[model samples]
Target: MAQNQFSLFKQKFFSSFFITQALGALNDNIFKSALLIFIAFRAGDELGLNSDLLNNIAAGLFIIPFFLFSATAGQIAEKYEKSALIRKIKVLEIVIMALAVLGFFLNNIWFLLGILFLMGFQSSLFGPIKYSILPQHLSDKELLGGNGLVEMGTFLSIIIGTVIGGVLIGFDELGVRILSVLLLVVSACGYLASRRIPETPSAQPYLKINWNPITETWRTFQYARANRVVFLSILGISWFWFYGAVFLTQIPNFTKVSLNGNENVATMILATFSVGIGVGSALCEFLSGRKVELGLVPFGAIGMTWFALDIYFANPTSSYIGELGPSAFLSQDGAVRTLLNCAFVGIFGGFYIVPLYALVQERCDKSHLSRVIAGNNILNAFFMVIAAALAAVCLGNGMTIPQFFMLTAILNAVVAIYIFSLIPEFLMRFLIWILINTIYRVKKTGLENVPEEGACVVVCNHVSYVDALIIGGTVRRPIRFVMYHKIFKVPVLSFIFRTAKAIPIAGHKEDPELLNEAMYSIAEALDQGEVVCIFPEGKLTSDGDMNEFKSGIERIIEKTPVPVVPMALQGLWHSLFSRKKVNKFIDRLKRLRTKVTLVVAEPISPDEANREHLYTVVKELRDDKP
Candidate 1:
């Protein structure tokens, strides 16, 4: 609906909600960053404790609340109207910030740690409401963009807050006073922004509340696992948090000890990473064509691992002579490479995370959506806690920070492989994505004519061997394509076809049993309410021209009687995958990045969806383009 993710800022409802959530993130990071710095620098002197031990303690304190409170929070989000609930949470933030001010003024480490726990608690309660409300407000077409904007805003706030907290907390008492006042102001502003958010009605108004965190937590995980893809998406998301926690948690020390950089240098590296994520998040709408494209997940995983491993090799040892400031650090050997690697890691991380969030929001049942998000928060916290522990164990066992980073990167690749293997959808989509983006520039028209949900048989004129992949990648839903049995078994593409659950059919002379099996499967798919795409001509054309309609489509309609949507693929005839070969060198060269179009016409009723009528519709849609 909107032109892009940026256009979301123009609407009052979206803008206000964005500001409210961003401010909340900002305040959380400011307080947490200030506390971590205090514990690292000042708390050790005052409390006579190991700074490292205290820092670990501080991290655990913040994360413990999510494990303890996320279940109850998910239920609360589901059972209440969201806007008012957000306002109340913002008010609670004001209260928490007030306590934070008292702790800062008194310079009490224990009291401040308590406030940190409370901050995490507030975040736990807000997590479900934060994500689940987007689907309620934004159209399906806008979901990816909306999530992208939110991710960008959240990361930007994180870096800004981290920088502000690090700088402000450095000035001793004056810094404490300024931070105290700033915290209250930001909290107040967040509350005011919350007040402007439009009401989001409850998804489960009559649902009973679960008070026990232990039982409710287990039940929440079950809710997440209700949909297998959604569950894997949550796991993928959690793995990202683990990867991020290891990298981000070690940055300050990584800069200080490994790079021999001062606090300012550490802040600069963190800022670079955060900014890269923001840029990547903002790029998702364009890259995914405003759809929840799972293809980007694998792409992002590869980049995250590549850049993270580069960070290890860029500076594996703490060999620098003296503590360098930001400028001097930038001038060091391999410094720019290290920073760029960090930035790309964040960039790919943004690409990895945004779509999964959108997928969870789109696929999960609305009633239990909030709870599933709560499960996500619980797992995220669990992973982060494990990351911290893993870092401690690895570093304590005589591993350098760079070695730890290398380990995390290697672990990321392993996990990505494992998850993708479990759900080949991610990899299949990635393959399709690469095929379309590299070989062709696709321009789609009338895609909205296809139904968003329910059973429908799409009739498209087949032009090339890769026609199914193009159609599958372009359409917004999963499609079970029917293809010739021999073509279905074509080596590499066979994996994609099987993963997509495509039905393979044979002619009566070739294999009558296979033909009967295919028809039954098609009927079964329609009975279960899925989109099944079939080429009415029953095979690809040798030349780029329409073929006569086959009556098999009529039998499909008679058995299932679902609405049939007509579609056409144009410009693909010239592709290398097509049977037609180009003898001219210029024509061969032009095959790369060929411009292609896929056109869809309105759905026709079953009674009118004869092979002849559908063929005419597709031919007209493809007119002058092929």
Candidate 2:
């Protein structure tokens, strides 16, 4: 009768984070769009600045803070309490909003440019704290939904801000003044929302501050490097930003040139992209069935390329000779069609980015989470800058907009191939998964009977080390298996298993550090839409008898909305790894009676998955005969 973990988010985390983050995004875009428009209209002649130069400078200014300060910020996040940091950042936003008002009043382009840099600095400082604190406030299961909400909220705010900025500036002097004041008020509201974000204790209180950006950045990379899959996933995330920046920067010109519409038309194009991203972001929770589904990354990337190329091909041949308003373009058949194509591309983008971002957050080392995220932000900035420059060069070299669009699509295919090739783990997991599907038949009923995908502790009777493998192999989706760190290093199996992205858990009483790693991974995996699968029995069954279900599963389910999928292995006790108490030599016999059936029971709600109930269910399933 208990509500799912996802419902907890609607009641608790959603409004606080969504409103705060969205307002922050809205404020950013409103100011940015207004400034860009102002520069285009009023300052161009006075400063002798061209559109491209101004834009490049804006991009440079925005990224400079990330390069200069993300490392220092990462350290600060590790050293201080997070809610206090959030409040402080929000206060800074108030001060920055005042500066925005002054800049607008003075009509000074340089002053406004400086404010852009400050906003970027503020965001960079907030980055590490924003991600690291997630593990503290939300349970493992709410991570993905929380992240998806954040993504959707951020994009939704962006579209709204852009539309408001464009529409407001069209009014006379008083309207522009009103808009600036509104931004300040909204920023203050963001601060108010921050007050609601619960406190998060520092991960590393005594960690030394490293002022050197290069060293700090390298250290962030090093921590991530220790985990190969984590490192590659970081790269994948950065690449997504690069792909996004390229498409985003092109829209203004694409609208003006391709659609031959004025500024209003340009705003509509931007709106489409924003809507697509927002829709895609929200869809992650559902498509993934509330688990961090990485398979969607490939699916999203494929959509990005498909629609991006389609946009190029959808280009209308007819051209207008003179300047026309947006209404003219809307009347043209191809214009609306092209815009929809671009929007669909954005929707796929959501699918591509949300899960991967969640994956990185869930899988990385917890202690150094802030720094790793900081490192990721730095790389994301670098890639975005590179993408912009590359796009500029390609355009300057006489590539038509459609040609450029086509090239990006082609490049996506190449980049996808390269990354997946480098980390064949993604492909390997899919391959093994495919093999499991083709080579063997799997059937289940009560799976839907499992509490509809929220955070709940799964309790399974352990028969073999392959218990996790068989469950993983048979499940319709990926699950983060919690195992002893040592078992994670087993021969061919270890290599294959690690690539499938299993979490290694060491008991806190046995190894504090490994235990810390396990908790962080579990929290992160749940956040990202991955099923955190653990053998509550803790170790493989030495005999056919079930071990006592541990309390760890209970602790995890209590925190998140993930449901408990109870499972039992039948017949695996007779296999090679099963116990033969009479003699050790007798147990060493090669595989015999290899047939195994894994019975999965209906999901138990967090409220229902108590130790006694779970043990009873698993016992019944394990004892069931073929």
TM-score of 2: 0.73
Model 2, residue 569: distance off in Å is 12
How many clashes show up per model?
0, 16
Residues 420-459, candidate 1: write the lDDT tens digits: 9999999999999999899999999999999989999999
Model 2 residue 27 distance off true place after TM-score fit, in angstroms? 0.7
**If scored against the real structure, what TM-score would every candidate get?**
0.97, 0.73
The lDDT, on a scale of 0 to 1, for candidate 2 is 0.76
Q: By summed lDDT, which 10 consecutive residues of candidate 2 come out lowest?
A: 436-445
Task: Provide the lDDT at 66 for model 2.
Answer: 98
Q: Candidate 1: what lDDT?
A: 0.92
The residue-by-residue lDDT of candidate 2 on 26-95, one tens digit each, is 9988888888777777678767778667867887898999999999999999888888988899899989
